[model samples]
Target: MTNYKRKKLDAFLSLSFCRLLSVIYIVHLPHLDATIEVTLRSMVASTFSMEYPKANRSFTSMSHLRRQLLPKTKDMPSGTGFGLMRLFTRKSPRSHSSKKKLPAGEQESESTTSTMSSTETTSIHRYDSGRRYNARQDIPYLLPNDEEENDRAHQQHWMINVAFGSNFDAPVQDALEKGIEVLDSGCGPATWTLEMAEKYPNSTFNGTDISPRFPQTIKPPNCHFFIHNIVDPAPFPDSTFMFIHQRLLSLGILENEWDKALADLMRTLKPGGWIELLEISYAQYENAGPKVTLLMQSVVTYGKSKGLNPGAAHVLDDMLTQAGAVNISSRRVAIPLNHGGKLGDLFWDDFKDIFMALYPVVGRLHSDLADIEEYKRFLDACKTECSEHQTALYWYRSCGQKPSNDE
Candidate 1:
């Protein structure tokens, strides 16, 4: 095993360290067979691709790769993870590169792993044990691929459904019933997609997320799930979807990236297709307790410090309009904390969903939060405050439509 010090970690936080650390963590955590070294090399090389012979315009540049790899570094924009390299490392004329030699024993192990991986089933490691993701492209998503996240997504769908009084608040609900193509961006656990698929058998549903948290088996015939990053151009060609629904992107998107993401979605959407973005804001509500306010402040501050936009939901409508969508509209669903109503109960659970994921993200970025026990008391205190004081938070739901030729 490699002995990594804080210096190693610091450089790793700046370099393509998380990608390497992912392999290390996976190797040590699991009873990895010969396949470990092969998978490790592939993932590592994929992430740290300095072998580009020409300038690849797909990404900003090679150094952009390094910035993309680490989100929890001190060198990044304070509290947020939006810092990519301004200076790019241009590729040299030569395609062939110098390969670093490994130890004799390590080389033998890697060689053996490669051979075994080819002959046997191509098994990929799943991060079901915790909230850690292995792939570099999956950095935007913060939630773990565990059953807890699966259940949390499930519960969240139920809460959203009950809160909105419908599965979706889009105007095309009628079109959905009549049968049309629908896309669920960032469809975590596939709960919303699955339920909607079952409900509207006529409508075809496609869901995409970086995390393979959704079950591949036991899905409806009309539904399909793909591992996709919403920030990139969607695999689906232009005018493929009649309706596109994205939920909870505010939690993951940086302040500056939503425009590109919105443009990508607009391109994939058909003329007159409806697009909806739903998010729960971390900003201050109409009423908030001291503990709750403190928690929100820390979350918002830490996120901005890293360059993420915790308040993205608050500005989603503007983004949709900026994307050149027509008929843009929004609704803010006020959720009172434990206000002796069923809705309050649902909002309370939603708060659980927020803080449950929030703790790990902040902990990963800041050392002081490594032990989340402190957050537990804070959550408990906030719960009591909600129950007693009727403090509230809001869910922002916005929908728009692509311009039709006639319009």
Candidate 2:
């Protein structure tokens, strides 16, 4: 046999032996002495860890394996098997020499440093139906991260600007004009961040997202991007920014995660700093016809399955208040779709792109939309319905301020 085949055979034989030993130990665990039981457990854990590193093993799969191999016993501690698996599989901490030192004048607090270091490992991206998606298993962001999506993001930014008449509504224009730290959470492609950075050169802008779609080499001097996950703690020190902007994260953040996500954003804001959020009322379009409504219903059902709230826009104000934000205010704009001429056409196109991107997700939930051709036809029907019914989508922009220290 070839060397590769030999290695495969050896691995298979080793795994089979390990399984047999595990079965035997579990069956005779009650009769075995304490030291022998511990030794057997250690041996099994070490073998598993040696065969599969932590990165190769998912917590869910490992938990399932633990359940299959070990039953709850009065003698054994709860979660003993799971804990042993984790302990053996845990990777050693990186040495200080391997750690990247921050640039001068960019020092971070210990907590922020830890958060940044944890995100140093890049997530693997997945491709389906010729579109790329983020590999963050925890997040349910059902959108492509490829160049086509970036172009759509750019178009969406301009459409929002036209609809709202400005890039932002917060009263941080003067601070931005002078010089202050700013953050753009969930900034896909960094369209708004790059534009704002160019418009207000005095202020420094930092954008963070799980995907690295933002510019790296040709970005403005004032703009910076990081491959950071927003669901986790913000990778910046407390009270770090005068302004924090997050938009279009309704699809990405789950309903239960919104509170923690907002809390983290608030944690990173300076005292009395403004934090703004913009989101479209997903699946809540006005005057939607039958076809449009059906498509939206599928989207809502898919979102609910993933623990997401499709109508997060309507509750932004309440969420901010619960996060302890003060001076909370909101603005809602109903942008016409397919009937408002140029802006409407732009929105229609953007909506089409969104629906097309969600094919992989909605297709699974809806059999009629399983095929791309059928999906396109459904989108065409929705467009005709929007044009006929004068459908409009509501965009919500909410702003709140961090309480000043004295207050």
Per-candidate local distance difference test:
0.63, 0.73
Candidate 1 residue-wise lDDT at 294? 68
What tens digits encode model 2's per-residue C-alpha lDDT throughout 22-136? 7777568569886676676566544543222120122112323454455444456654553443322222222211234333454333321221122122235544555556655
lDDT of 1 by residue, 1-407 (tens): 33324433444443455466543733363365545534543454344322121111112223334345434456544533322221112111211111223323332122112210111111222221123332354355445554445545555666677678776667887898999999999887776777677678899999998767665744566788899877778889999999999888765676777899889999989999999999877885857877777667767887787667878888888889899998988888877777857567656765765665566554544555455565566678789987777788888999999999798
Clashes of 1: 9
Flag regions of model 2 displaced more than 4 Å: 1-123
Model 2's alpha-carbon lDDT is 0.73
Q: List the residue pairs that clash in candidate 2.
A: none
Top candidate by TM-score? 2
Off by over 4 Å in 1: 1-130, 134-138, 361-371
lDDT of 2 at 83: 49
